[model samples]
Target: MILTAFLTAAVLVASGGTATAAAPGTVAASDREVQFVSDGVPAYGTLHVPAHRAGARVPAALLIPGSGPTNRDGDEPPTVTPGTLKLLANALDQDGVATLRFDKYGTGRTGLGGLDPAALDLPTFTRQAVAAEQTLAKQPEVDRDEVSIVGHSEGGLQAMLVARRVRVKSLVLLAPQDLRLLDLLKIQLDAQVTAADQTALSKVITDFRAGRELDYTGMSTQLATFLQQAIFSPVNTRFVRSDDAVYPPSVARPGPRVLLTCGTQDTQVPCWTTSPLAAALRTLPRPLPVDHFQHAPGTRVNDQVLDPSVVTALRTFLEHR
Candidate 1:
């Protein structure tokens, strides 16, 4: 079963490292290998179904990855091999909820012929997400009307766009940013620079805004390009303006049940940034329930750190609703 496999993996990971395994009661009941096709590209994922709900169709969640090359398990560059989503999926499975977590386009086992991160725009990602949703809806054990999406970070933006085009039942956003793409990137860069030199950081921001590439004598071309894209790309600017420009009143179609979460320590997308997003959603003149969950005892600016409690909250939300 999926839960059993996760327990086995947890035991192995815990025994081999300083990390603690999930408490016995927190493990899932079962899991299985599942795959789907998106735009002729084969996408792979794992479907964790609660053991108690065997033979019964259940509410389902599509787990969308954050930015970069994060795979189905939420692992990305500089942090390879961590199965964050897998662990979350297992925990949710224990609660009689099924989760489908897949790799972003051109990542993991998905075909890469037409995939290029640098060339990708918001709509491209949204289309892929919608395809993934439809694929999940067609599964025999998934209740189409009860299917929702749980997107983390940038994927949260993608989830919102996807919802506009699909009939998702609910949405859960984790540490989502409400700022325009360029502004968010500038904030992130400033934070990183402050760790070293405030003066240099300010200069770098000025240079970026002025369209001058920063000096990267010691940095690789890849890192340089990434920084450039983060700061100057029209893609990010457009995404931000488009999202902000949405007329909330026009989106009044019985909105999906929404849950927005952020960590107190999340530096990449700080609580302050996430608060505005939740506030904006609350302003929508619709009759939908919107909830916010800010992690207690929040850490300082390390959004990459995985908190098991977040997973618990997600499971509770999906199961009870």
Candidate 2:
């Protein structure tokens, strides 16, 4: 779902400002929409500090939304359904863990404060984690030492990037592919194309891999537009246009306990099948957390599922671990 659809209101005004609480599908009270500055750009997020929040420092986590222009809530515009991330924040809040989720650059209320959207790039987006961490740590209700991040899809990789710079109590990467963006795009494209178009699309992958333009004749407009989003976007061009897959080495394995997950039916990032990233992760200095919920059937198993299971995993990791 990295392909775009990123939508959401700029949820979260500054602290002590008007506390516009959005209707919680599962809870009630001050889930404040907060804002912070990341590299001179104003960023917005919803800080889910539970109404029942007690103690001087409860464990909290920053939830990083997935690929594309995904908003703070786990979905994009025009049709914001039951949000995957709003559900996640609700789950964590229920477990008494505070959570924060934000809109990336160029999306939501981020660039409206005068920063040119065209100037935003991959680092502009990724470095927001550091800013988010700084902002979240300052909250009186959060235990900064126990703080962690849960990154879904590309955000999972973004979590890895942030981990490279800071130490967290733990990290959770949901449905992340270790393959570079260009390579992963190829896999996604191959899945959606007809057999007859395979050769040409393969050529597209090759050309793209080599830094060549996707100059083709008679290719479907859908494919061309997908190329623009999947490859040529300003942010994507800056970071994801590489052959270097940023998982194995970028992540300091022995540093923090990490949880890696993949949905059985998640075709977008089929890390469950392609590349077998676990094999690489297993040989690291620290063993990745044992893959939870590894059931197949009779247990409400899924050849198909959604991010609700992800909510359970997040709650388990942040609350129990």
- Whole-model lDDT per candidate: 0.58, 0.61
Q: Write candidate 2's Cα lDDT for 1-321 as tens digits.
A: 322211221222466522334444423335677877533446778887765423446777888887666778766674543365666677777777788888776557553456554444445455677678667777877888888887776777777777777668888776665666666666777888866456667777677668787765556777767766656666455445432345433453546777777656455666444334555455222222222222232333222223355656666666456
Weakest 10 consecutive residues of candidate 1 by summed lDDT: 1-10
Tens-place lDDT per residue, model 1, 1-321, is 000000000000001212223444443344555555544445556665554433567888888776656778776545454555666676666666777787665567553545443455555556667766777777677788889888876767767777888898888776654565556755776665433444444565566556576664444455457655653355354333343344322332337878777665566776666545665566321111111222234432224334556756676666558
Determine which window of 10 residues in candidate 2 has minimal summed lDDT.
Answer: 2-11
What TM-score goes with each of the models? Answer: 0.68, 0.76
Angstrom error of the Cα, residue 219, model 1: value is 14
Q: Pick the candidate with the highest lDDT.
A: 2
**Which pairs clash (backbone N, Cα, C closer than 3 Å) in model 2?**
5-76, 6-76, 7-76, 7-77, 12-33, 12-34, 13-33
| Root-mean-square deviation (CA) per prediction | 9.7, 6.5
